[model samples]
Target: MDHPPRIYCYRCRKPDLLCICADVTPVPTRFGIVILQHPQESRRTISTARIVSLSLTGARLFVGLDFAGCTALHSHLAAAPGPVYLVYPERGALDVVDVMAREHGWPDGAPTFVIIDGTWAQARKIKNQNPCLDRFERVSLSPGAPSRYRIRRQPRGHYLSTVEASVLLLSRLEGSEEAFRPLLEVFDRMIDRQLSFKSGESRRGVRRPAPRPEGG
Candidate 1:
């Protein structure tokens, strides 16, 4: 059987041999990020967890629908020392006000952060299955600007992808909103590539859109 000549992933707009994904390294931060990703989200070609984990050295990524105590995530959580803050949206459950209040009351030290990397529904499941997480305070973001991530759109304006949420948390903890600028820039570039690939695939047979300018 003649298979169509293997489309080079770069040409096909998929992950190429030299794709940036392979070289992703973690960055250091005051808060450690433990991302529990849903298995489905892990398999996605456009997984944002990959982006965030790669960009942050202090970050660890785990993939699963539920944490069953036997999973690697259990070990990680068991080893975590600081207070864990769950990054989720929904005002009453966990919000900035709650964390800020705790931070003020604490006699010493900051908290460790646990961010769930999946759809809002999947994240809630993660929280429910991992009873240990309940011991930690849940964290919700302050109302903010719209998400820059285009591939997966959140129904609620306040909801953010895992990477965005992590970046926000780091920014607040480090006392410099600008610290996360590099992470966001890297994310923006990745999103742009995904968008470009989709556009090309959508118009495979139609007149090609003008290529982006050389500098971009």
Candidate 2:
């Protein structure tokens, strides 16, 4: 039998009751963000890329796998008032610390980060397909703690959700923790809300197993 279509919140794109849109004060950062999401990631209700888009002031999320010649995506980069950087590579990319030390424009919020959101395999495919993204200066993070996202299984303990990664990257690059607190607050709420909902469903004896989501 076909399941009834779930009613969704148009803004956050979550099921209406599961929406985490309350008290979301868009976090403003010195730098900008652009998320190139895999089409598959866009289908996951638990995906945090939407959270980054809704909770960040100057961030944008575009859903696709390849965007090498995407007119809009490339045009936005060209029009950016500052530089752009891609985030990836387990190694060899410039460390976030080094970029702060070496890049003069970054201090003035002149660098926008472009992140690819998807499963590890999917993110790899997206990057390989997009030459426009590969050509940018890539940046990597040194995780201080394990990922806080418990519901999803990460390929590694240090893999962070999209919002978490954005929060860490911007907070470090801009040199302020307090400025990005609201984003984390919202992230916690979403995780808590989902946890509660799932537990409640179990208590009610909904036997269907939940599908595992990929790390953002």
Candidate 3:
């Protein structure tokens, strides 16, 4: 039997009925955002990297692995207006606030943030493979509220969604939490809509396929 045509939103790329495009309002930031997304993560329907890209002005999104050889990324890193930092939770990484307070104080221009978008293991792989990123200073977030991302199970409770992490970082950098509030609102709405869609499917008695056994 022929399936019904699926209508998708041109901007958000989600199904038309679940599109959150109207809720998106691009927020400006002094700091540049570079998102390196894993190929698998880019394909996830519930992934937030796209939303983060759309929400921040001048944000760059590059997909794939081994960015060490990416000339464009290397050029961007070289020409960044201020210090470049990788947003990962490495042992030696400084908290965002502490980084702002240290040594010469905040730089004249906003720092560039390199965020890896993927699962914890995938993120680790990206960091490991990209030797070029090793030169930049690493930064991490201070302990905050538990993650609001309910759709996916995080390896730990502290892990935030890509968008959540971006918003939190921006809030600290901008020194005004109010400015980045809309991004979180949009993210929350997206999650709620997805949950509603799943509920509808259940009500219609559409059974999800059972999980496949490993190595089966």
Best candidate according to lDDT = 3
For candidate 1, give the lDDT of residue 33. Answer: 83
Colliding pairs, model 2: none
Residue-by-residue lDDT tens digits, candidate 1, 156-186: 8877777787777777667677767767766
User: Which prediction has more favorable TM-score, 1 or 2?
Assistant: 2
lDDT of 3 at 184: 86
lDDT at 204, model 1: 73
lDDT of each: 0.68, 0.84, 0.86
List model 3 lDDT by residue over 52-88, tens digit each: 8888898988888898678998898788888899999
Cα lDDT, model 2, residue 72:
89
Query: What is candidate 2's lDDT per residue for 4-96, written digit by digit as tens?
Result: 677999888888768988848877776879999999888877888988899888788898886866888888888777778898965679988
Each model's total of backbone clashes: 4, 0, 0
Between prediction 2 and prediction 3, which has the larger TM-score? 2
